[model samples]
Target chain A: MWEAADTPNVTKEQLQGAMDQRFSREIRQRLAEARVGIAGLGGLGSHIAVMLARTGVGTLHLVDFDVVDLTNLNRQQYFLPQLGQEKTHALCQLLRQINPYLTLLPQTVRVTEENAGELFREDPILCEAFDQPEQKAMLVSTVLEQCPNTTVISGSGMAGYGSANDIHSRKAARRLYLCGDETTDLAPFRGLMAPRVSVCAGHQANLAVRLILGEETP
Target chain B: MTVTVNGQTQEGCANVLEQLTQMGFDPKRVAVEKNGEIVPRAQYETTPLKEGDKLEVVRFVGGG
Candidate 1:
């Protein structure tokens, strides 16, 4: 069902080479076959999406209801030209440009507890990248309560300018993966900047990749 | 009283719930550990904090 990107007729061998020697061919193959979902398209979600795509992740199920705004330019991976475009569509374009072979399912709708079941069906692992705590909790709890097989990787407290060392990844109750400083709150006293957000995003993406590669920390 | 919360010692506050609120943590979003034992959310108000009591309170943040 997957057509070659162009008439040159590229092969899986070259696709694997995109990952190069840094990642094993076996890992690349595994990544190529893995299907993952990102629940938000904000700073964290966009970064995770890019990292996964660059790692040769074959499929991405992206959901975002918002559009690119000038404010998002500070941290999110989108460019200035992408402004005013629907975030899901803009992100899909960026991802496809990076890896044309990627299979992207971009849904331009807000995900709520009611639709969480339908939105994330069949994906083995989902990254919780919402900017709101209630939304994150809803997706996490909905999937865990309704669909027992799905694993959720979520971030919390990754706000404010702080030391990267403050951020950590913890396996919370159930199958939830929490990545962040665990204490940084977005407040008038503190702000959500790029460095700390990226730190949490890296942790979330790393855990997703590690899980796909079949590594269990326990 | 002094309690070691999230690895830092803090003075005042007698119970876990009170100490959390005093420190600007919303009890609703955080998971608390007292001396390595995970405390049920229901007991935060009743769980008394004593001198040298070590506590680990972790909460989720919003960004990205």
Candidate 2:
């Protein structure tokens, strides 16, 4: 368990140096300059953002309109004190704590077809982490049809406490990659759990990193 | 005609839209890709599923 008192005060240069020791100079440079857009700050989005930040993704555009609620605590990357706070704002705070030098763009608004293109126009890769089926389909369709240059990484069917191994990533289309079991659906008996959600989120985040590194296939 | 959908081969000649409906999928809640190219939702009705065409129809569900 980490406490504020135990937090080590480190300079940005020192942190960058530490990261440089792990990843090749070229890889770290690419990650430090990559601008990625993530829509939705729910279970998958929040985790994906944090992972990207930890991996040294320099610029991230986090979009979400919902607020942290009691129900979101089970699988979301938020604490009890963050209840009622907008997801975008709360996630930005957490991400800043991870990498202060990262460029964070937190947008607290519902992403629709009209605004998604404009919001993610500059990003080469867009992660679709919306919860509802309609929203997911809408965003994927919007990006694929309108934003031809942006590759979409989407999550689907990561519900229920099923086998974590069942959740895997795949190249769904030419420019679209999907992460999840691609079959499991939510239900009263098979509710969304933390382990499986994180497993799927890991796939999405890892896939994003791979794509950033020019590894197209999932 | 035998067509593969999501890795499962099925015997049908239905177009993308008709095949999705027959599979009990909500047309508005899924994205379809045929033969390595994305079949836009607007073109689903006109996108013909030829024999041996590979189709990847991904349906979004309620989760994060």
Candidate 3:
């Protein structure tokens, strides 16, 4: 239990008031208690993770095995100093800096069929950010089969020449939103650009917030 | 013969390849589902069209 301060102290009302200055107290409360799991810390994942953290999501489960490469600077949040650092670690550090109160669980390991279940057990809302088509397919299939109750929003086909209109929401199944291009051949090897990936991440974050607030997306 | 492309009816000829070409589809990059069954990319050219065939073609692009 927190003690009452002798001097004038910040009350829950004051905290709530401060939150209300920017967002409704109810919305802030919901954001403060939500837990989001982001898989992959690449271009798309970095943006999604940062937005969710800044939005006041209380807990974040960040997973990625790769390090920041020079190429990632074009879009990823990692700075030159953070290059060679594990993406999950770098993103987690950034998230903590953005909101010191945030609880970020960083997993510096690749998500695979063998570990996806265990990693997602702590959080029911998951975001899939893998760039490889085959890996994305594997992650989505495994999550659907193993964590049927959890809501999963995945990114796909965010490459090549396309507009924001290409970013779409498809109901792959009950409680599953497939965000991004649903095309199969848009693998990263086929040339994924920065702006397109960011666009997909924006959609993912928006969809995730809607789901968290108990709203239905078409 | 008749086939459906993206919910639009198209004229299907004896040559499926020529029909696809006429339908403004690039056989190289699109995945074709014929009557709910996925047709392999290799079979796009040789497979013959049939009357009342329903086909779904999905084109892929890259990002993230």
The CAPRI-style docking tier of model 2 reads: medium
lDDT of 2 by residue, A1-218 (tens): 24556667879889889998998989999998898899998899999999999999999999999999999989999998889999998898788788878999998998887877788878899988988888899889878877878999999988987788888899888888989988787677776788888898899999989999999889
Off by over 4 Å in 1: A1-12, B1-59
* Predicted model with the maximum TM-score: 2
Ranking by TM-score: 2, 1, 3
Q: Please give the lDDT score for candidate 2.
A: 0.87
lDDT (CA) per prediction = 0.80, 0.87, 0.73
Listed in order, the DockQ scores are 0.26, 0.62, 0.20
**Candidate 2, chain B, TM-score (2 decimals):** 0.90
lDDT of 3 at B38: 51
Q: What lDDT score goes with residue A204 in model 3?
A: 89
For candidate 3, give fnat to 2 decimals.
Answer: 0.36
Q: What is the clash tally of candidate 1?
A: 4
Candidate 1 residue-wise lDDT, A61-123, digit = tens: 999999999989888988888889999998888887668798998999998767887788788
Candidate 2 DockQ vs. native: 0.62
Per-residue CA lDDT of model 1 for B1-64, tens digit only, reads: 7878867889958888899899998776666667765665557899898889887765655666
Candidates ranked by lDDT: 2, 1, 3
Compute each candidate's TM-score over C-alphas: 0.76, 0.90, 0.72
